[model samples]
Target: MSSSNKPHYEADPNKVDYDEGNNRWTFKPRGLSIIWGNDRRYWNLPDQSSFAVDRTLNYDMDYDQRSEALSGPHWKGDGSSISSDKACPATCRVPAKALNIIWGNDPRFWQWIKLSEVETRSVGFDEGARLLQVNWIEVTGKLPTTMFNVASTTKYEVYYVMKFQVDAFGWHSVPIKFKVRLNGQETAKNFVLESYKEKHDVWHEICGGEFTVSKNAAGVVEFGMFEVKSEWWKGSVVLAGWSEDDVSQSQQTREETSYSQPRHIEETSTEAKLGETKLKRVEKEAESKAPSGSTRESSRF
Candidate 1:
């Protein structure tokens, strides 16, 4: 860090706020970034892309990896990590590119959009997976239980953070299920997203389910959004991202989020079943009762 590095770089217009009334975002740079950041990258890049994404030759820009999971502190203004923004013990956030999205990379089925300045700043993700049109709708995510301390009494929640496009369709009747599984126990909640269509473009954190961390939990906590049972075609919805959050950690103000050393897990770690890859087809459950030790609750708006 230097006392006069601000002259080395310029303020990023997209990252810094631009108030029409106040004409914000025109402020002079504070200093050179100590490291890679969201607003500004290793250089003046929008975001970094993976090798696989670069070779595809179709992406507008590499998917921004900075917004998902990081091993350091998050910045407040433009990549400036304030000393006041202390770290928590641990946390996890899976963006679209980091999740096992069914046909997520395919151009015909899904479109991955690099989040705009507003989206990146507001939702805290660099990209979102938008559903172009699809019959077998499924997007999955998971995190190893070891990320959390061994405290079975700790209440945690999983949420699929997403929103709908104005022209989104084919979700009026069919219900999309949100599921969370841990320690071999699982909980499932279903919601008809059409109910919220009136509030288009708004982000809705559809809670998969809440559960206490289990001592027996070892492998990974499984969570996802699925609607594979139907033959119905669905389109025009954006899957921003998802994450496993400690209830208490999430309640803090945006400025004081206690996300400590973040670790990136395998994006496609959730192994697919025999028939899922070609096209996932979920069969109706033979048993209506939930598995042992699992709780079932109706989802409410």
Candidate 2:
């Protein structure tokens, strides 16, 4: 916070924008790159091991913990709060298999746009309920599917949106989802799912922690994210990363792991069985009344 303490740091070339036509360059620093006056530098050097990322390792250098630690004792970044650009590392050496954040979908009327109340209709149940539901979903993925240029590409690109609704004379919680895909097969291998909620009206961007996918021996792969608990109550399902070289192993495994509806057993209820029997008798009586030659006419109706 000293006016005279000059901030000393190296100028990152990637942060500098070059205009060939204008022959001018614009430098965009990650926030005000002001170094602490205490001369001690704690910069970690990037090495070859850092670049050789296997399936297990992922470098998501977001300043969440660092910023939070700095919040109490020392208000870094002028206490303006941690931002994505300032929080995430300027350069990350991630695994080739690790998927990056890509696209998301939060439909207003996913299941039912309009909120409503309905009464229970079970035989022995009598109750009324009111709940919000999502019936439909739409998603788009293009920019996040683009290739990353080592020389010219920016360190991080943001592609998140917070969709929220208003009800009960107040604003409801916002929905957040991430656009994620594999690093190499960006376009052909990508999926979408819900993101974490940071606050009442804000959803935090999906971190690199949740992104997961794995390749098998047959060159086939499996990848997906966790189910999002949105308005529908039921979780979402998304799949990406398929190849033609395998013997249907990944697909079978995915099918085996997929969510299934619970089965409903017909309990032996005498009254219900009696009702069904009576209904069948009524149908049989109605059929008997119809003339034999009128079968075709009744069927058409």
Candidate 3:
């Protein structure tokens, strides 16, 4: 296939649809995804697994969608959307467009790849954003109250759904910036990706902080994923998109919304995310911070 500088998914700017009754905007999936996130309705793997993509599929996994393309049974024709799950009503899937992936339209730094043509087994998403190479990584998006009308005096969190490729680089030395803002309040954090770089090819969620909705705040939430100051070149990460949900509800119903069936998970993604430590944190001397090269396996923030 010939390459184009523009993102393939951006062809249809009006892809997302608003669910008035639910007070949320429906997400459309187009490219490379790591996991199906917490919703089984969106992935090919069996009922239990985190980060909704092919990495979670084991020998016992029942991925019926393997028979055809993501555009079949689960995804839309153009690989632009996820099938709706009524059971998980509060969870909202946001498209990659909402995140405003920087340099997404430029083939030199980023490109969109269609997964169905290259993947042998059932993968995640229809198309994914491919980082060819970049010295500065920045992905930012804003959800206005006009689109997502959340309840007043409630808390919600934003996540950029992504995964690093096997050949991903520059993650160990530089820290990633994840931040979120609502009204005038903002929360941000720096996470060291040293432990995570080696565990490539699996999907992960980096929280861009959380925000509380209030009556006078207007309810607009902004979030981002950035690694600009380090100036180290990084490449080979596939970004699926974004997801949002009530912080309180997620803490309470994680067991229910995490998977379709029950399985024994020692430390759920919730534990990794809400439970924070140096495992994911990066200090002020981040630019020179490198992993000891010790085999550290898991990570969360």
Candidate 4:
């Protein structure tokens, strides 16, 4: 057979070139390599050939069209001419002595704050939000001592702010109720949260009532929430609290001593217990200053 008349056939389907000098057909397989973007939908065939291209594949085109649609004006009708209003300024200010705790979500914050009968789980895109889901009957935790300092004869008020949410698939006949306790005593009345019975999972913040702490109190305040009825209801809880006033002079003195001269502050008793002793002294002083009164019948004459 003549070299020019020799059969020039390519065994591999990928090759587009032929070696006429050597009378050999190059066999290179066409590869259908795909490159995917951050989103799986957005992809391209980087190593695809004309013969390997699939006419029905519209991943790249669909992704591009979707991106363009999302980039368009959020509001309809003359969006270019629409003026944006300035955001309203904050009217109230947080007090300097205010104590706030955002737990479970923030690793930098306190983790010792227990969440009984609940589990900590991440939610939202990329698991940005950490939530405590109630698995059993109730979720309970103690308030951190950093939030308040016990004082003698001076009452302290504590306030709690919590966020809650229900599972998207979960539903309940009755609203889920919250019962807040401070040192085992119910401070806030039982109430139903707005997120209860929500079809789609959404976070809702609920602020509890003020709980007064007596001067002689020692134990940590407890906070908890429970469902009204036994069901497979699940929700998340995030807590925060603050005290009514700043640390008292006695508390400041003790704190300064502990830091500056640790030997001066006794380790035998806690600061709260010591505050109770000071409260007794305060009561004695007030009693000594009061004048004695005598009931007599001479006034009637």
Q: Who wins the TM-score comparison?
A: 1
- lDDT by residue (tens digit), candidate 4, 207-293: 333344555556555544443233244434343221122324324533432112111112323532443454345445545643354
lDDT per residue (tens digit) for residues 241-299 in model 1: 77656777755533463222221112112322222332222233312333444322222
For candidate 2, give the lDDT of residue 74: 13
Off by over 4 Å in 1: 1-91, 150-152, 214-217, 249-301
lDDT of each: 0.54, 0.25, 0.51, 0.31
Worst 10 residues of 3 by lDDT: 67-76
lDDT of 1 at 235: 87
The positional error of residue 156 in candidate 2, measured at the CA in angstroms, is 4.4
- The parts of candidate 3 lying over 4 Å away from their true place are 1-89, 116-125, 215-217, 251-301
Please say which candidate is ahead in TM-score: 1 or 2.
1
TM, every model? 0.54, 0.20, 0.53, 0.29
Error of 3 at 64 (Å): 53
Over 235-257, each residue of candidate 3 has an lDDT whose tens digit, in order, gives: 87877777666777765544544
Q: Look at candidate 4 and give me any clashing residue pairs.
A: 14-30
Highest lDDT: give the candidate number. Answer: 1
lDDT for 239 in candidate 3 is: 78
After TM-score superposition, the amount by which residue 93's alpha carbon in candidate 4 deviates from its true location, in angstroms, is 17
How many residue pairs clash in each candidate at the backbone level?
0, 9, 12, 1
